[model samples]
Target: MDRFEVLSVFFGHKTAASVVAAHSHPYWQLEIVTHGGLRCAFAGDGFALEAGDMLLVPPECEHGFVYDKPGVSWITIRFERAEDGESRWGGVIRGRPFTDRLVSSFKIAIPGSADKPYEKAFVGGFLDALLHYIRSDEFRQPADSPGALLGQITDMVLARGGRAVTVSELAEELSYTRSHLSKKFRAIAGESLKAYIDRLRVQKAEELLKYREDSISEIAADLGFGDLFSFSRFVKKHTGASPRELKGK
Candidate 1:
């Protein structure tokens, strides 16, 4: 079955300063800071995560944190992808629907919530609810900070599948001028607007090549490339590998 299965769940309490070295895993993980604070680094970018904040780390992404604040408590849910929903993005999650879900999940977990061994099914249910929420337009919670804006941008790209979009289009969709939008994106993400989109495209293309049974040309067109050559060039330029090589065929 292509559904997410909980591998392990734990509620953590830290009383002293600690550092978790960067590491990667083949499965997905969710971390919610229920109390105190933590500085988490994903892909070398540091996000000061506090209470009422959450993080969903995707497969194979290197992440770690410095828990310097005593009395910090968190819930870590490690799960594997038996389900095929790649529409989700990883990063700092805060405010609105996401936070609301975090609180509820913990509330249930604390009092025999599914984050435990005997009640792992509860975690799966929570994940299903989350996936459903993410697939809906209602998931576009208001962004009160740059971090929220970054999540919005990531969601926008994932929502696009493999298609291409311009900065002006993104700005227009977000109701901001091209320059202003790009500046904020760069400041928060530490990457140029175009680079981020292109990188996202490359990631999508790589995923399709590896998993989906789409032909090279078809994948190229799906990503909005004018031709197979252009798509091949893009994949090569960014990843130093051709689609065939990536596909291992």
Candidate 2:
């Protein structure tokens, strides 16, 4: 079957810390925060990133985090290809995944709610501006080369399904030391790589149980689990349900 993708960008704020379980994107996730902090778990590791930060997470990269304090606002842009060649995280683009690079913040300050007409218009314009900003080289230097590198990495991760990928391996592929890449990845993507991947696996397992014809054991193996017991345990831990029970309902 062909993968699906979506593209979107929006800003959000929070008042307290919230923990999100590991899960994958149906599309790509790019987030830039203007206020507050975020503590995220990706690919089995956790990181804390604050304002003046962004994150680039490919599809199916397990990740989750807590929104620290309140008055936290951020903008996220998701992109994906329309056809079979591109796959994405839901409401985010993951197709043609890329490495994280510093990009200038495109802040569109608008005051209103999503229900307000002016707010809608402002958001629309904001998105348009954001797309243009990324397309421009204000964020990436050396022309398009660096920017292209970011995109290439994302695309590769999404294309391969981003499962069981290690930090060392990712660093090696990008010709960076693990720590260097980790720092850069967090700066651009808004979360650690490991956290994202872990979220991906759990999220995929949920979908498989909910919507697919595959059995629990089958789903487990497909997700690279060593055994059904482990997969079952994971499912129970996350959703408070056994695979069979989730499907049975």
Candidate 3:
């Protein structure tokens, strides 16, 4: 089975003076606070997370924060969902309640120096183990729960292969009114449906640019962009790179 792909990982420290403005990313983020505390604002809500607290911020959520105390330290892993929709983390993590055990498990899995020869494999295994613990009986939910619905919607968006999808279309297929679906989605997923779709499309474009020999124009058309210029703007907005630059990377 495919698993979540770790795009980057690092340990960071912040002083009381540190501040980050509202920003969003196109990859899932797992952050574990190991020292001091942080004040985070997301989805119009605020949270004070301290030592042993773990926060999972889904893609496209507008979040910002500041250190609440001196010497705030944390471990962050940015990851992308598997193209095959088989990532264990994706299904287990959406709207799931955090637990002390889960926090401890993540702390234990923290990676060593990035310079280590086995760093990548070690971090990947660590994430797999952490997800394993989270998927245990204590954290698992019924198939009909809100978390499951969120997971289902995520899978559908990913499976579209960058095809444009609207909230109304998804709601109609799910037998829900658009307004109700939008509210519930934001409440559970921590981001708007449109933002999620945009990020997913850019992610798909990145994959195609890296792995396929198709011309940029072909990719733009395939992703439903009106023209190359439109696709260029969309990619730059989300990824901060043009098609040529991304392909070079």
TM-score on alpha carbons, each prediction: 0.52, 0.38, 0.45
lDDT of 3 by residue, 162-182 (tens): 988999988998889999999
Enumerate clash totals for all models, in the order shown. 5, 50, 0
Q: lDDT of candidate 2? A: 0.60
Q: Model 1, 1-249: lDDT tens per residue?
A: 236678877789899999999999999998888889999999779999888788889899999999999999988889986646455477876645455655676566655335455477666777777666555554554566676677777767766886988899999988999999999998988899999998998999999999988788888888888998888888999999998899885
The residue pairs that clash in candidate 1, if any, are 2-82, 2-83, 3-82, 3-83, 109-113
lDDT digits (tens) for residues 166-248 of candidate 2: 77877898789999978877776787877655566667777778888977777788777899898888778767889898888
Model 3 whole-model lDDT (C-alpha atoms)? 0.74
Q: 1 or 3, which is superior by TM-score?
A: 1
> TM-score of the candidate numbered 2?
0.38
Candidates sorted on lDDT, descending: 1, 3, 2
| lDDT (Cα atoms) of all candidates against the true structure | 0.80, 0.60, 0.74
**Residue-pair clashes, model 2:** 50
